[model samples]
Target: MGQLMGFLNIEKKNQKERDPRKRIGDWNEYREAMPEKEVREQAARCMDCGTPYCQIGTVLNKGTSGCPIHNLIPEWNDLVYRGLWREAYDRLAKTNNFPEFTSKACPAPCEGSCTAGFVSDPVSIKSIERSIIDRAFAEGWVVPKPPLRRTDKKIAVIGSGPAGMACADQLNKIGHNVTVFERSDRAGGLLMYGIPSMKIEKDVVDRRVHLLEAEGVVFKTGVDIGKDITEEEIRKDFDAVVLCTGAGKHRDVSIEGRDLEGISPAMEYLTASNRHLLYGEPLKPDFDAKGKRVIVIGGGDTGEDCVATAIRQGCKSVVQFGKHGRLPENRSESNPWPENPHVFSVDYAYEEAEELFGTDPREYYVETKKFTGDASGHVRSLLTGSFKSEAEEEKKWDADLVLIAIGFQGAEDRLFEDFGIEKDPSGRVIQADDRSYQTSSEGVFAAGDARRGATLIVWAIEEGRKAAAAVDLYLDRKLSLLQN
Candidate 1:
């Protein structure tokens, strides 16, 4: 709206990434910030459509169609275009609790659903978002503003990932005393350990954690619920409990030689790599990919991350196996727009692997038959077959290291069982009321991956906010009854 027909006139452009060859040498973020003027120009491309699908925040055909947190995309874009950066940040903060996290890690379904993208490229919404938040931080507009009033309610948030962090932030902002319990030494669950540093640096996560601490959120790291503390203690100390423990049970490949010494889960490998980079911990021999021929099983973001991490670790060779065929260059008829266009686009990891290996390391339509290990009980190679071949033609590739990155099944059942929470038939997520996020027990609720299985960070944040609201309402009702 600021610039008429801006979408047509201003061609879409994205923030530049550090060269794959150069970026692979360091664990820092690969993206370079776009100039302020160019970012504003990109914001101007937003059409401010009557029906902005980018903010709909709905699911279509099992894929997210827009921003799961329902960010005020057009309003902020117009504000940025008009040089009202502070206002833009304000609007962004209204929905997203952690723009810093999502802007960098989220897949950006909002851009896929942008109205301007119908004809031309989508507005560089993700880049604009990152710019706005980064500028906000630099300008000192972001600070800890603790609630002015205090409530008698005290809530315990289990897990320190995006959902748990968002839930705790919202509850603390509403005058509740919130204590976040993390099982790891660091507070950030997925953001700290699960994701590699090349994508999101640890300092960024620490900055937000420090701000939350300043806002009076107590974080208890290295404390495991149902182990270090009992369920009775949590119930007695806290007025309410919200479960945000993510679905992190990694699915495994039960193929031959699975128990080989060099085979590990992708999350385990990534976590070890992050710990090694952050705390100077030595990587275990099995987890270290140096001088090894690595093969990542399964094709997803996790697999791509494995490929990148292996490249950084000086792997001799790397290949990723995907059961599905390669995606089409463009969206197929079945995969329409606004449904998270499942077309082919090289990700940062793939780009880095291609740059280093002289070709993309992905092999699609490949099914692993078995792993062959050396006499020392370490994986030596893997046998794979093509899905397209009628005879199931087999091929073997040398693989000194194998990372299983298939994906997570869901939340660990034992955690929910410890709290007396019910799980659905799949036994993956906590069974809770859909609207209230409340579990079978009173004064207890569940949100994020604990309730919905593995999902995007945006959805986890949204669930956290909504679950916080429900918890607030529940606490207020209890208080009213007590006063009576």
Candidate 2:
């Protein structure tokens, strides 16, 4: 370690977030980078623990407890402390295909499992990671690294989400002629649409996609793989195919008033907002939350995003319902240290709501019974009852617009049916082997949410990297060449 006693001397310093009052006025990332000197000081807090649990990538209590991609966190942290910025970036790039995405979007299970966190605050791993990658970008250290020679092998990656992007990027590195097909107008599927610009600017995703193009990866947007292009056509053109379409079948809140005019799924609302920002497409009058009282169902990451988006769109008021009660402020005996903490902490969106509305928008222990609509068939109010209380606890809240941000079940069935792909009973693509990401059909593979159900972006990247390796081996064996 650069500073043996740095943990005791220096307090945990996190990147400063922009003032909520000012940040919510526009759609931009709210986080401000910490100064380089302070980032080094935070990095110096990494301990010399023999078993660094932060990078162990283990699952505890049915939840991820550390970096699922097995990032070399300690090595990079030490390098940062030594002022070896480039070295830190190199070590980080070796394990993570896209640190820029994870640093912003991930919940940072790695910090929860940090050994130093057992007693005191954890090392600011996410901040250090963001610093390293952002510095590299500013220095022009991140550039196209095309393979030396072409393998003359063709590969098609369906979907341009994180998993598909990671898979396509890796395959391209190994000299395979890779093409990514996206149904949307943009190359990045969820990153470009589902996530608001306030979280990750669209240009950041565009920069990486452009770099991939420079490295000889082909991206075809507005081309539906299973619709405009058939499965037979893809198989005929490419030597292999990897399905990364993601879990798009959103779980619906099929209550009595689901068909009301003012109700829509989270993705539909988010996609509309993204399109409005990127293009000149105006938000639909009904979907627009401006001056409307909004109710978001399901308190998860998607719900938080809805809250943030609604605030930015000038909603009259926003309230999110969490079916489950609030989490504990500290871990209980059942959930010990080194596990992903379920402790309560305010997210960026909730903080913004607190600043703008003078109160948190989350209401726990609330379950929706049905929705009521006005004479025009537009939703007017929501009917709800307490989760654990008596029937007398039923309440009604006025709402002009409602967004169902519950969750996703699996990938859309149209693609699977078009490809004749086999799926598990739970609707996940059935891989031939747990270790091998190959699907039932030859020369076809599955990874990310399509195979594992909806998960974190970090997990999608990890699965994509692993799937690329599997595809590389399959191609090498067929060509009688050593694997890259």
Candidate 3:
């Protein structure tokens, strides 16, 4: 460790965020970068524990306890504290292919597992990570290095999302000819459309895509694998095929008046708003939340994103509904140190909503009974029941626009069926072996949400990299850098 007792001397300092009142008026990132000196001081707080659980990457109580990609958190922190900026960037890029995305989007479960967090605040791992990558880009250190020789192998990736992109990047670096097929007009599947622009600017995604292109990854946008091209064609054209299509089949709540005109899925609404912001496309009236009372169902990350999007669209009012009780202000007894801390913290969306409205927009312990619409077949109100059966209390709330932000169930079955791949009970693709990511069908492999179900973006990248290694071993009977 650069500073042996730095944890005792230095206090944790976090990056500041823009004022909610001012930030909600624009669609850019709300957080400001911390000064280099202060960030170094924050990095110096790392204790460099004997057993660093921050990079253990284990699952506990049905939730992730650390970074799934197993980032070298302590290494980068020590490097930053020692004023080795280039070394910090190189260490960060060792395991994670997209620190920019994870730095901005990941919830930082690594902090919860930090040894320092047992007493005081955890090291500002996410902030330091963002700073390293941003500085690397500014210093012209992030450049493309295309492979010197091309192998005879041709690999076709089905989706252009995080998993697909990561897999393609790894394979391309190893001299494989990789072609990514994206169904949407753009290459980034969820990163470009499902997420709101305020969280991640579209240009950041574009910049990475351009870099991938320069590295010899061929991207075919506006091409649906199952529809535009048949499974036989994919099998005949490429030596091997990897499926990285995300779990996009959203779970729906069926109830009375579900056929109302104003009700829409959260992805549809978010995609419309993103298209409008990026490509000058017109926002449909029903999808637009402007001048309407918006109610988001399902309270998680997706629901929080809906709240943020509705607030940006100039909604009159916004409320989010969750059926379970909210977490306590601090970690519970069951959630011990090194486990993921389950506590209530106001995220960006809630902060923005609280600033715009008088109170927090979250309503817990509520169950939806049915939707109530007006004479014009448009949703006007929501009928909900208390979660407590003893109370049996029913309530109603006025809503002009209703967004179903419930999480995705699994991947679509059509694509798997088209490729003759077997599926598990939950509709996830069944792998042939625990170690190898190959599917039941020969020459076909599955990764990311398609195999493990919906998960964090960090896991998706890890799965992609691992699957790429498995593909290499299957083809050449050897392993490469990705395997290690």
Best by lDDT: 1
Off by over 4 Å in 2: 390-392, 480-484
Candidate 2 per-residue lDDT over residues 1-484, each given as its tens digit? 7588777778998889999999999999999999999999999999857888999887899888899899999999999999999999999999898889999888899999999988888899999999999999999999999899998899999989999999999999989999999988888889999999887999999999999999999999999876799999999999999999999899988789889899999989999999998886989977799999999999999999999999999999999999898999998898898998898989999999999999999999888999999899999999998887865578999999999998998988988887778788766997646567998888899989999889889889988998999999998787775543
lDDT of each: 0.91, 0.91, 0.90
- Predictions ranked by TM-score, top down? 1, 2, 3
TM-score for each model:
0.98, 0.97, 0.97
Residues 158-270, candidate 1, lDDT per residue (tens digit)? 99999999999999999999999998999889899999888899999999999999999999999999999998899999999999999888899888888888999999999
The better-scoring model by lDDT among 2 and 3 is 2
The local lDDT score (0 to 100) that residue 433 gets in candidate 2 is: 60
Report how far residue 313 has shifted in candidate 2, in Å: 0.6
